[model samples]
Target: MQTIANTTSDFIRVSSEIGTLRRLLIHSPDRGLGKVVPSKAQDWLFEDIVNLDMMRRDEYDFYVKLLLYFLDPDKIKGRVANLAPGTDRGFFKPDHPDYFASEKVIDIQCLLSDILADEVIRTKLIAAICGIERTSFKTQQQLTSVDPVELAKILISGSLPDRTMLFAPLPNFIFTRDIGIVINDHILLNKPAKQARTREALLAQYIFFNHSLFADYRDKIIEIPDNEHAFLLPDSDTARDLSRSTLEGGDVMMIGPRHLLIGCSERTTLYAAQQVMRLVFDKGVVDTVTIIKIPKKRDYMHIDTVFTQVKRNVWVLLGTLARTGDEARKQDVMHFFAPKDLSEDLKILQFRKGQEQKPIEIENLEDLLANISRNDLGATEPVTFIYSGNNEFPFGAREQWTDSCNLLALKDGVVVGYDRNDYTAEAFRQAGFDVVTAAEVLDRFERGESSPEAIENTFIMLPSAELSRARGGSHCMSLPLLREGF
Candidate 1:
């Protein structure tokens, strides 16, 4: 890992969703993404197999450039003008000497490499990974001899330097948010619900515990313990569902210093949600924990896919999924009298730390988010919402599927999103926010026409032609480690 001499403070806390993000964890698209075959795409949580080169050069590189410009301007300010726009990917590669190795924007692969350099950690991690992948002992032995940098790449990409595959690639590792979440200076590691993501959890746990950067906050790391007799549980669906203690970072949000929101979606089980509520409450990390349960379906994989905070009082979401009761069920003349789909119902329950006897029930997503803005963050302005695809028919659902609701806030009113969500961008423009493309923003920054501090209430759009196919947005790509508190 690279160091920043100017970075002195050891900050690692998140109080609000829309705070100015100073540090985050990200993984650039590696060879593993290109290995995701169509046969196992859905099994690995990908909507479709992506054109890896396009995803790297055309789409995700813009995201990296945008983040660097806003968070660590010195690393990319004037240098971008010299590189070939679409073809120069070496600037983003961590191992490449020319790569923008910003300490502020840390990459997980580099952290893995840093830890793997230790002989003991390397042995233990290799054993652990082999145990999980069931690779032959010879394969494990072969990995131990590889250089730390190459080993780290192979571990994540699951491919050797010569393109030999020893095990399945961790394609979903790009979505760093699923591995763990930081809540008020405490890291809450995830217990993933899916089997395909087991390696990701293991790697993240090792990084948090073994990395020098996280050494200061080791005691603050909160890991969800599996349910009693969880190991002995049968393989049947009913049996596993009864005690599966799974929680994903996507379903978690440290919305306020004293408030945490968890969603019980397809990726996060309610068993894990209840466990987190008790855990955070007992730790005194938060006074309140809210569980927002949405339909357990692929379309709404996590709460973030449905809504994310843009500002203290402003939020963007899929209105189709945020409404409740009659409002959610659109009433046309023919379907007015038909039975409502109970599965679409959105449920909310709030648990106070010491007041567990009287849990509060919130009616719907809008009311819950609005309450957080007012009560938790002390926003006095009227809570406003920008809907997916401008809340139009079919477009809302279409855009939401492409992660229109998923956005990462750079500061209070500025966020990063995909350029493909044209209607959502228009909605932001309509709402009096400046919407600019990532390439254009970088150009402006390079020309000294714009700077991060002066940029406010702006939507920094990224090229996402290939990224959208991976079924994640910028929010999913980032794991905020430190942010300015509200």
Candidate 2:
């Protein structure tokens, strides 16, 4: 472990050293269940309130086995119990003032205390926490009459009257990669916008700053003076409610130290993305931050929903939205956010003398399918796009909701995808990739199987009903610390 004293050093610029990936951080499932329930699971940021014990144990097995596979003990780490040292603190606790004030009061602190102090309360707490009610059927008028904070308090108390409340559940903790953005050897522990995810951020802050596995690099944290909320708003409304513009790490991706591809979706705002870019640019953290707007649809909610890079310039593009007829003529609406010519494409084609006029075009699904086969010629690498649906039917609208395009890149050519996507697997196999089944992975999770394993070169495909409902895939669930050539 190496520790440097320059606190202002930037850690976002380095091209990832793929083979030397010894230190990667993760968060196993924890007290996030109390925040999710059948009735309010949708609003709580979860698709369902699962069994906490099962989820945690499964997550433990996943992270543990992954670490074992890597064979680098110090390289793989989890921050579930690491957030609050010597204390079994959950994300939500009733004792915290926020619990009483907010309708989603999970009381992570008090709940953790009870979990540690009494086994009986822990069981009851888990039940109440995961037994929350849903408001999906409530009319707008009916919902408006109840204060959100008051409703949250009532729900927590009603569900689990015996346990103390602490904090709201941290649903985003599973995707640890997005919580902090790395710049060179430094990491900026972002002050997240959502209160629910604040504890997750705090836990991450603790891991990077205090834990022996990663604490040596504390001085590398980006510390802006007198700007606690510097990472939140762009010097605009400092007093505004933080939750209104809530952002998460899953919605952002670092293409390189200088260049980035961020998903501006329902969870992350366009202004928020711009504000983040401006903040980092001012510090010379990055040169370009490409704002890839996610189409406003449940299925196409994130950038990773449609496009994902496999090797260098080679990408597995899911051709879902095809523009034809009148919609195609209005250039702005059709091609505004379309993946016409990405920066990666520009840099890879060594066009000299400002000859950057090469435009990558794919008309319909057939055109895109044809270009991929022809584009990588002379290049030994196998390249192809696995069409999510059959070519016979024009599944323009249906593809988006079905996540026909979202595939997790394992190595340069290898990938892990949904088993339900038999067509996608066949396409990849045709493209010369060893497409693996997610059934074994899901079965391993259900069986409480545990062993050390490395997460490198391994794309774990989790159950994505809730996540897919938000329009993202395993690629959205993961943040890469290493790339092949980098």
Candidate 3:
């Protein structure tokens, strides 16, 4: 239980969801959106056709604004107040000052700038891109001569002049949580389920490996060897065979210090989960690994989209999974809803350094969770569950589809989510959380009207008119590197 202050390295460490966020990794929806056409939207993993301009202006702009505000409230507030009068501040606190501060918001581009500042890293990146593109020597020379910043943009956004689609637009790269998860003191780079997102994993790996921010824990990074091989040698037979083991960050949840819950959902495979457990055990990262087998459906793609911990004891969960209905009991699609027969669905693996792996069965998710809290957390408090749509059918289905369950906790009892899910918002309100808009929270903080500490059970809602269409919530869009200890 090391606190963020006591922790020696700044690379990676996350124990619980409801800890104060310290650092994050996010990607802006830029060139990725440019590559997504209507005919190839489904293949590119987009739910519906999207206008690139709208995504950039309406969705990504606000998303970045909200994140920057959370990361540095005072700086962002001051910057916004200084902006020109007619400028669309988006969700910033309205009209306090009209000055312009030229500081750029921290995003993937900023991180890439930092990474490319190093000559060694810049050279390696250029060579890698050239190798991937199979470009000619003259083209490689031209890329080497170009400025690092422009080269980074080319690497991420792609280059039409060179006719090299080195890294195709990573449309889904906006969901940073799907690329990596921090556990204990290390980073576990995820292997995405689709080829469209493979470049994102490479980009993350390059950052953790080359960027000075993560230099302290370069060796501490953990990733499936199969994924590494696939990224480096996509055409190799070895890489192809090893690619069968797949795991995405969206499926992983670090519930406690030594308790990790991973879901075998549409994106993660059972073999991948087993492999991850072996690596964690070898590294002495956790004592137990609980695999929650969720339904393999588009709507239920990841566990976080269906279940998320909002408070110490309270969880916002999909209503349908919490209880068995007459229709479910009568049918036998996956038997995942058999509340009485938990052993059939839940799987727990116990591991130690030199011992063989042991499997344990449980009756249901509740019992499994209760045991985890008791054994791992050493707490006897009863766990509480809040339904997404208050046990309503179509409403619950609708809200879940819009990622009502996928809330990102800034700290205990403080979370950020989309405001479109009214039913879910009401549920949180009834649970003692004040549903405040991002603008309201920022305005109050800037005016010295209130501090985050002064607020209790607050649910900050982000404007997600276009973001919601991307089919990811706040949690999906962020990769938290550091969070204050709970």
lDDT of each: 0.85, 0.42, 0.70
Displacement of residue 308 (Cα, Å) in model 2 is 2.4
Judging by TM-score, tell me the better candidate of 1 and 2.
1
Candidate 3 lDDT, 262-363, residue by residue in tens: 888788887788789889988988877778887667888998998887777677877666543435432332343343432243344444444544466554
Tens-place lDDT digits, model 1, residues 7-101: 45556888888888989999999999988988988888787899888888877888888888878888777677533456764446688777898
Better of 2 and 3 by lDDT: 3
Runs in model 3 deviating more than 4 A are 1-11, 56-62, 82-87, 90-106, 130-142, 159-167, 227-243, 324-356, 370-381
In model 3, where is the ten-residue run with the lowest total lDDT? Answer: 93-102
The local distance difference test score of model 3 is 0.70
Give TM-scores for every candidate, taking all chains together and pairing residue i with residue i. 0.95, 0.54, 0.82
Best by TM-score: 1
Ranking by lDDT: 1, 3, 2
- For residue 230, model 3's alpha carbon misses the true position, in angstroms, by 11
C-alpha lDDT (0 to 100) for residue 341 of candidate 2 = 25
Instruction: Kindly report which residue stretches of model 1 are placed more than 4 angstroms away from their true locations once superposed.
Output: 1-7, 82-85, 237-240, 324-329, 332-344
Q: Kindly report the root-mean-square deviation of model 3 from the true structure over all alpha carbons.
A: 5.9
Regions more than 4 Å wrong, model 2: 1-22, 51-67, 70-165, 191-195, 206-246, 321-383, 387-410, 438-473, 479-485
